[model samples]
Target: MMNALAKQSTVLDLIDEYDRKAAGVEDAIKAYDDACTAIEMAGTIMGTYVNPVLRGKAYVHAREMQKNLLSSGWKAIYSRLNIDMIASARDKKLFERTLADPPPLTFENAKATFGPYLENPRSHILRGLAETFAALDPAYKSHSKVKIGVKGLPKRVILSSFGDYSGTYGRDKLRDIVNALASYRGQPLMEHVEFNAISVAHRRGDDAILDGRVYVAPERYGKADEYQTLDRGLTIRLFGNGNAHVFFAPETLKDINRALAEFYGEVLPDAEEEGAKPRTGTAVSKDLQFYWSPQDVIDRALEFAGIIDLKEWRNNSPEPSRILEPSCGDGRIMDGIRARGHRAFGIEYHAGRAAEARAKGHSVLKANFLDCPAKPEYDLVVMNPPFYGRHYVKHIRHALQFLKPGGTLVSILPATAHYDHGELKGEWRDLPVGSFAEAGTNVPTGLLKIRTPSPSTQRATSW
Candidate 1:
């Protein structure tokens, strides 16, 4: 009888496994059908029934704005914004699917949504902050920094940075950090720490010499290259023989000790204890929020322009070339261009983000793209241009002016603008991309590949 019972258990386990696999297949099929059908329908109604291109662009940009609002304030703003977008779309099929696959959320399992801004150095400087979070908050885990909106208040920043490259480079790379007084936003995270100038040694013709190799990264967002404005330039440099040299700031020692203390207080509270509490979006909690990651727009641009094949790029576009993005947000598209080992430049409208972009080792400016003068020469144009603008007519016309004859204009625009707007007349090959509504978390649901013809071939189509 016992052997018979064991055999019964094995059979039941197999049955469960088979059931899961079957469900997975079903979801995949449903998503594929939904996306493909939606794309076909969008093409048919470019000017009439459904302008998915417009709706898709609206969703992506709105999500970016939502992220900004939440960071300026708390969770409710981010939560309500995304939920409202879903509601507004009223995609009956999408709503039903979401209900079927309700997110497994929990405060204990939640993580902040950092998006693609991870390529920046400020992203790295937040390591110490996360260490502190583990020490101070029991429910928090390793997650991206996010902003949330609070009621009766404008907005507020919560969460901390996700480890990026800032920490590796020292003070210059880190943009946001608390100052030496253990202060943040001109307030104190602590009273103080003892400061003393100690001898940092290095070999000098076999004799050790003293050098000041000390610095402190902020506990939060603080600009380093722009430190003069804050009057917080604390790092010092020491030069040596044989052209040998080093740079250091003193606050780093104190910062290390603080992190060590926090680490002990928090991360070690329940050490050596691990159990499966449902890992992948499986927890049920109130605080877990939706996360959005941006696309590799720059890389997509290369493929869209037919500059190189999709699988292998650097080898194909290795020739010294110029690349540009008009509305680059946090270097997502710009970084892609840089990866191809080409000279790249981008224009962004937000001041703080422009600075943030520069801090991430990018050549960026805080200026409206439309106001900027065109360079009149670039090999390729890769942009997911802003959809909400009438003045964009001039912006696109100017951007196109910069491109050399035969240069590619790989962009994402609302299909409605492709029809209704009084701009963008050219011999264009539209590569119709379907919505990843059910697949891509936060993304351009659809894409149009635009090509600008030579002056002689251009026709002025009245809109």
Candidate 2:
């Protein structure tokens, strides 16, 4: 009885194996039939037998019971996975094992591979694409050496269309692509390439209608799709070669050497040598005071409190004269203070600029406010931070902590900072100077000041 039971169990397992094999064959046949019918109806009958042949081949291999159980489903699963591994694989022979090129990395390919950015018109979808005269240059330049510099081993490139409602689409993707390009070249760096958006102008009467808003009929009337697309407001802009210039942070440039090798096969000997050094350089510097803009919040404090006159504001304190200039740019204000014969000190975050300021033989702290050591802190603080972006705010908050209780803080901030957080309050009124202006395309010249009274001193001086 026991021997019979064991035999029965083996037979049942064998039956299950045949069941799976039959099901696979049926499903494959159904799919092949559907594909063939569609192709034949469309009058494309040339490759119709290919899928059916593959289906028959799979069934033939699975005819045996042992093979069915051991190999069924698993080969299909593995072959599907092998598709991706083959495409990304460095080995050329891997394709035979995979049997196919992998599917495109669409934003909706899978939960892991697909991302939400694909839906956004502004998102940079195509990253690390090789720049071509056909793609980038309207007319191909035979030997144009003007390559967009990518720093690292770049793998993909992201491109965005100006037809976006919200403009925040491709910024992060652009950043990632730049970094990938740096990494692809066997190095680790990337350079940002910003392109300005533009609308082709139509000559209307004497004035050129620069804005491409007016979508007329007949030219687009027959095509409803084109009409909707053209009619719906779209900004004609994308990244690369544009009117709006963007700045890259230092970390962004660090990946450029790697990108160069990956994108262009040529081995850039200089990039390899440059990347090897411990202290690397980047491509960014504050444009010298040619068009220096003041921070309105800081400027307002200075204005409200009245300018601390150059004659009276000078602190000639003999007791180890101390002052702080956070985000000090080329030590302009600090130099002015020195010219007034006041022993002033400062802190600058940029290394190149800091060195420039320090070479003047004044004690300029060559450290970031956030990262600087607290020892021998400042008694007075001053700065003109980046107004276009909020990176300066982080430094501002850091500088505030460095000040002594009665320490003076002088700064120039954009007026936008006022309305941004006026209701929320703390440390804002530390100075009482204020100034404002509307047309700040050049220097706003608006200044403001605020002062926090020290309990130690009964006397008051204009900030």
Candidate 3:
């Protein structure tokens, strides 16, 4: 009986001490609230004063005092609770919910509720505080309004700012959409458009500004696609993060929508009756013979070889040189070469394509490039060979034999070809995804630029 009475007495003493401490905590909280109110009132009065110098000095002093108070108070609270001052988004949300209608303010309850936050606090506490403030204060809640115009975009093209929407189209459909647009616009649209990653910020009064860099192509084509910058006319910006922005002249909006809708299915509400139908083309075959390199891609390959510059080649007088394209189908690469005032020679196995090249005033041999003699005569050899299986490797290796010592060979091959060709030494650049969409293939491709070793360098290595 005596031991039990002693235990009861100890419990009573603890309860008493707890009550007293709780009372002290309440009083301190009230004092802090009063101090904050007093500081705010003083600052407001100082702002109204006519003397700018005195007001400025007072503001500085008050800000410093407030900062010190907040820092000290937060530190004390964190130390007392044995909890971190920071919290992750999930933990912060949990904290907010717990604080909204908290249980009796007890240590056990706090520990139970914020156990996860105490374990890991990855984000700053100020963000949670700002959110809380925004909830309570109208001024804090006020944000700049953002309006994105999407009526000019295709109906199938989804728009998202805060990542709330999943797109309706898959990558293949998206590529087809871009290809359709390119056909309608009668130019390479992939190089001019941006796709599959975007960030938006508020500009002034209902306007949102999007800022992002050009999408560099990946090594192997995945479900994601990338678009480049278009300087003239319409600019379409699409992000992989499900954000999209389309900027165009008011007059061009109709044409732009029509172009996108050609492959995206549904036309805009205000589209004309002569709306575009979905593009139909020959499907990609296993042989990969139908893949025609886009002019932009061909130009990029030539540029990689230093044979021509897309920007200045037309303006500057051409330095006549011999460039070769093996298995050049329809003379697309040859056309790019001749446009730069270089003599373009092609070896084509297809009689029709060879005839077409000849029709374009290009000197093309109507024979198999592999069967042709390997002569170190050309200054540059630029070609897009067959991509089926390991045929590209064979073509690239054979093409090297035609390069003069110190001559560069630029070829477009499968993205994985670089890895496959362990014996060949070259620099590889990934072409953008959907680069060959208009060419009847979506296989990811890359540019390989390799230079034949000069005779002196070869001799030194041989020694």
The model with the greatest TM-score is: 3
Please give, for residues 1-463, the per-residue lDDT of candidate 3 as tens digits: 4555544333234334444655565465567667665765675664464433323322224334434443343333334443433442334346445543445434454456555455633212322322322222222211110012344232223335423255443333333333333334444434324433222121111222122344534435565455444433434445557554445455444554332222222111101112323344333433234467897798789889887544465566656777889888789888888777677889888788789989989898988777888989988899887765556677888999998899899988765466443455689886754466566554456788999999999999999
Where does candidate 3 have its weakest 10-residue lDDT segment? 264-273
lDDT of 2 by residue, 154-208 (tens): 2222345322343644443433333333323333232221221121121111211
As for lDDT, the candidate ahead, 1 or 3, is: 3
Residue 208's lDDT within candidate 3 is 25
Residue-level lDDT for 442 in candidate 2 = 18
- Identify the runs in model 1 with alpha carbons over 4 angstroms from their true place: 1-293, 296-299, 309-318, 389-391, 419-422, 427-463
TM-score of each: 0.34, 0.30, 0.40
What is the C-alpha RMSD, rounded to one decimal, of candidate 2? 25.5
Scored against the true structure, residue 219 in model 2 reaches a CA lDDT of 37
Residue 43 alpha-carbon offset, candidate 2, angstroms: 99
lDDT of 1 by residue, 1-463 (tens): 4555544323234334434544465455556667766776667844365444434432224334333332322233224333221211122224445443333222222222212122432212233343332332222221111112111110111222212221322221122222322221232221122011211211112211123233233334554211111223233222331222222233433343333222222110101112223223211111112111144433454666655433365454456567677766577666666655555677777666567668778888777787788776887777655433344455567788678765777665433344334266654432222121122211112234455566656544322
TM match of model 3 to true structure: 0.40
Displacement of the residue 276 alpha carbon in candidate 2, Å: 23
Candidate 1 lDDT score relative to the true structure: 0.39
Candidate 2 has an lDDT of: 0.38
